[model samples]
Target: MAHPATDDARLPRSGSALDVAEYFAPQRTSSEDLPEIEPLVKNLTIGVLEVLAGVREVDQLARWLGEDAYRALVTRSNLSARARSARGVAAVRPAHRILTQRLCEPTDGVVEAVVVVAGPARTRAVAMRFEGWDGRWRANSLALL
Candidate 1:
């Protein structure tokens, strides 16, 4: 009998296993081999989710947060910092259906991302930016996103 494709095997082919490997392979951002964006994107996503669900306190964030994200959220929750920034809120939250465009590395150290926020007759690009900080690509700004 032949083996079935596992979950990760379903990724879009990069034309060959070598390309596929290079595409998904972990590269060192800060000496460790974690894919730079995954964890940070996840933390940012969770913070957004919690805020949308009316959990605004920074302490509500999980401690396992990738550090850069932890600090970003902390700054966001601080009255002095949050009040100074003119940021917009997403009209539809995650439970409503959120889509993420695959992140692309357009330059040497920066990653560009497009998160689509969807609602009835509405779709908006939540433009996100990330920088490699201590081995992870943490959200630089939701306001910019």
Candidate 2:
């Protein structure tokens, strides 16, 4: 008799046992991997700000955020229409910054962060939460400040 946990038939066709070991290894928490994840963070933050500012619409936010985040953004917009319009960013500067916190459960995933975008007159902080869905990081919720 064989145990289901050790089912050989369900294993990958390629890669040795050591390969599997390396695949699940703990990820590095240095800025070395930051560049790879930068676009997702920056794009989503800018898009959210644009939507709040009325320069962009709600539907446009779907590209960077998940359904829940989209709904949350819409609700926030409705709640404070005047503020969003007044504080709308004129232009985002070239050098925005991202801060990240690694997840505890899984090995390699960034679950949350704060993105700072500098405009002509003001700097806005976009608090974002992300989830690994379909092998990519998708925004789950965002708050504009």
Which candidate number maximizes lDDT? 2
- Write the residue-wise lDDT of candidate 2 on 1-145 in tens digits: 7787799887667888798887776333433334355567767776676666556677876766778888999987665566645787453223434444232222354467777667655777777776655455667777777
Clashes within 3 Å, all models in order:
1, 0
At residue 123, candidate 1 shows an lDDT of 56
TM-score of each: 0.45, 0.54
Give lDDT for model 2.
0.64
Q: Residue 135's C-alpha lDDT in candidate 1?
A: 59
Query: Relative to the unseen true structure, what is the C-alpha lDDT of residue 57 in candidate 2, on a scale of 0 to 100?
Result: 74
Model 1, 1-145: lDDT tens digits are 4355655665565488788777677553641333656556545555654554345555565333445555765665564334434454433333535666557777665676666655455555555666655455555545423
Task: Give the worst 10-residue stretch by lDDT in candidate 2.
Answer: 98-107
